[model samples]
Target: MDTQQDWDIYDVTIVGGGPAGMYAAFYSGMRAMRTKIIEAKRELGGFMRTYPEKIVWDVGGVGPVRCERLIEILEKQARTFDPAIVFGQAVAGMNRREDGVFELTSTTGERHYTRTVILCAGRGMTQVQKLDIHGANRYELANLHYTITDLSRFAGKRVLISGGGDSAVDWANELEKLAKEVIVVHRRSEFTAHERPVAQMRTFAKVLTPYRISGLYGSADRIARVALTHTETGEPEEVEADEVIVSHGYDRDFGNLVNWGLEREDYGVSVDAKMRTNLPGIFGAGDFITYGSKVRLIAGAFNDAVLAVNSAKMFLEPSATDMAGVSSHNERFFEKNKAVIEEEKQRQQN
Candidate 1:
């Protein structure tokens, strides 16, 4: 494992742990650059972690992969480079020093210095909205959850999903197959989710509209039922439930990056074709960056990562190769995995 003392300065410091950041770490390793990824969340995957059960069909080279599975594969690919990964830390501030190195400080007081910085901090800081019921906090440790990590946990249980957004409806649809009974409670009469999924969810799950969870009722350790009130009629009803999922969406902001002196759009930072920000020695990628005709897809973010990493590499060392060649044909691949490659080669020869 590479430690702070192992290198005087990192070749690249990636500011996010999403798909773009993870791929950048891998590519940086391919380029033999010392790399570190700092993520604000306790785990990697960024927004993907929120809806781990969601099926992803847009990512390249994979068909109908789950969000959690994609993240697992991406994380494994990133680990090949052994990049130093720091979780639960948010970049609080950053500055370029006279020595031509960038210094970064995290909210936790951790400091990192790197030759070049890659801004992959997608949507800056993000947080899931929580259930606002009076006693919801008491059951949070037990049956109440803001995010679903495992679908099996809901098996045979009665699940109550709150909210009308895409994630809420999606989870309701997914949990309907695992749970004994699934009920979707929304404050508004109409759902805000995409029409197709919402229509599909209605076919499997009981949809309760124009109603809000008025009160949570149960033991201190777990939730047993909830009281719902009609949004307009103010009529009350009770529903038996084993678990409640709050998917009110997220409260995401650009956070400290808004004040970082970089050119900004209403969405995020602005970058050029090379993924270079207005600041030298700094680049941006993924959902955190804005450009003309940006696709805002995982594949597009990956392209951004490649451009950013290559630009940063050349910026740091003008003599460095403009881009790392194909991994299958690159000498660095064999050099780094000599034992495994040799073993595979011998197995093939036999």
Candidate 2:
């Protein structure tokens, strides 16, 4: 299945198709730069697609839009610039060559040689961390879902969400009106979510005491009950529910770019305000960069994309003479690849 290819040169190559990467592509297009977006998954909108039904509480300037709604808007804006996007291709390795260009190798064995590399790949390919309870695996592909991709299906059903972070609270608020009953389970005494959302959830849904999910009980095929154990007293209880939604955050492992030897500040790639990494042509935006005042919101990522694109543009054209030609070439590339650039999707049904 590997359609391996040699290095495809690009002005900027953005890894990960999340909000950050999407905006990066858009900004690159606005700057008239030849850019390519590579996403591991078949679809765009990385984490946004993971919880399309949940309400976005953090995106400032936009009032509590549904995750899927934001994805649609961002995807549309990203495509307006007309950039080549490759799906189902995960970045396997990246390195700065002696010639000052980045050599990026994808998991599918495709090569991309780019003048600048922007790592907007937030959370580096996130997946739900599941609780390995008995009977959980059987329902995973059916009634049970680890991440809240669509909340409409649970409109009238009783749903129990596990986790205390912002994600758990976001779902609780988003599905309170949709679901018949929403119960939040947190292992700690205090909520990890923002104060406003926590207060809102208390008024709408039932916030459970400090407890952890013990196991899941089911009937012939679907989940029927969830067992919980109190953190302090160790008291056990069982609750009947129609669905179990686990929002216990995600595990981020950047083994793909670990060998690049880039400077690390607080376990992330060190970057300036323009999202430029320690390496001359390498930059990291979104949640992948290390900085004192870093914002991980979708809007913040978009702003970062602007800065990174501008820096990349200047880097590409150190002299003012090449600027006009670069812009013209990028415009031509975008117009020619309009059909091939947009609407690239891959699906995995296993």
Candidate 3:
């Protein structure tokens, strides 16, 4: 619990409370590191909060787990290590000291000192791109949404989604079973998403591409029609709809972290095989700091946590070598925390 005006030192200070950050915190605890996780949200699980009803399909060693269940499991795993958790605190700035420690200053003027820093912010700090169309602002609050969290509300309703990426296709597929009619419009001719979800969506929904959403036609209570444009001929058309979902990716605001001498490429922060950034004591993992190998999946980010934690351990103890041997240590750590893990599993089942 770090309040403003007092500087509390920790072994590692992890930014963001997504899957990557949560896993990093768990590993930090396993290594017996005094860690603190700083999250902007009131609770843990970043985008997991965005898909409460969606099923998580890619988590390895796990069945198609519910998003809420995954969140509970990850939260429990993160806490099993007993790391000091800080929520609703956004990092305004950060700097690496000459002594190799990282100093983080939050928007609330809270300052944290730690031997290492791991950023797992993901795309949470970014702004969700929207279809800048006529009458967009009116429905922006009432009928328009940037992300999908729960699908129950969409059942028996007509939904129009804009975008051709994995998100748009995934949502289209998910809503197909629930919603009355699902329509997906993409600016690009070809979908950039994986073939599986794309195929699934095409089986049920109307998939149109190389078209842009031009305007919103609706009354005060709900959205009724969506104006669209053909990319090739500039032809315009309108489709009736109940709700419009825009998912064209996002733009990030790294904030003053850009001034902290952090090593980041256009993709994200750069880190080595061990998740060690260019700065010795400053490390990054997950979507925020992957160098060349960027896997946006939660499972991939969890692997990044393994590397980052190992690197943090070696950095704290310079005499350490062969961090590969830390795997047994990790197993022991998980074993010690098995009771909590079992509790979460039961909760998930119940």
lDDT of 3: 0.82
Which residue runs of candidate 2 sit more than 4 Å off their true CA positions? 1-7, 56-64, 203-207, 320-350
TM-score: model 3 vs. ground truth: 0.81
The deviation in Å at residue 147 for candidate 2 is 2.4
Give per-residue lDDT, candidate 2, residue 254.
71
| Model 3: per-residue Cα lDDT at residue 28 | 81
Identify the superior model by TM-score, candidate 1 or candidate 3: 1
Expressed as tens digits, the lDDT of each residue in 117-224 for candidate 3 is 888888746567767765576777777888766677788988999988888888888887799999999998999999988988889998777899887777884688
Of 1 and 2, which scores higher on lDDT?
Answer: 1
TM-score of each: 0.90, 0.81, 0.81
Write the residue-wise lDDT of candidate 1 on 1-350 in tens digits.
22456375899999999998999998888888899999998888877887787789999899999899999999998889799999998997988777777889898988888999999998668877777665578888898989888889999998999999888987887876789989999999999999998999998898888999988888878889889999999999999999898888888866676788999887778999999999999998899999996768889889999999999889978998889898889887776678778899999999
List clashing residue pairs in candidate 2.
none
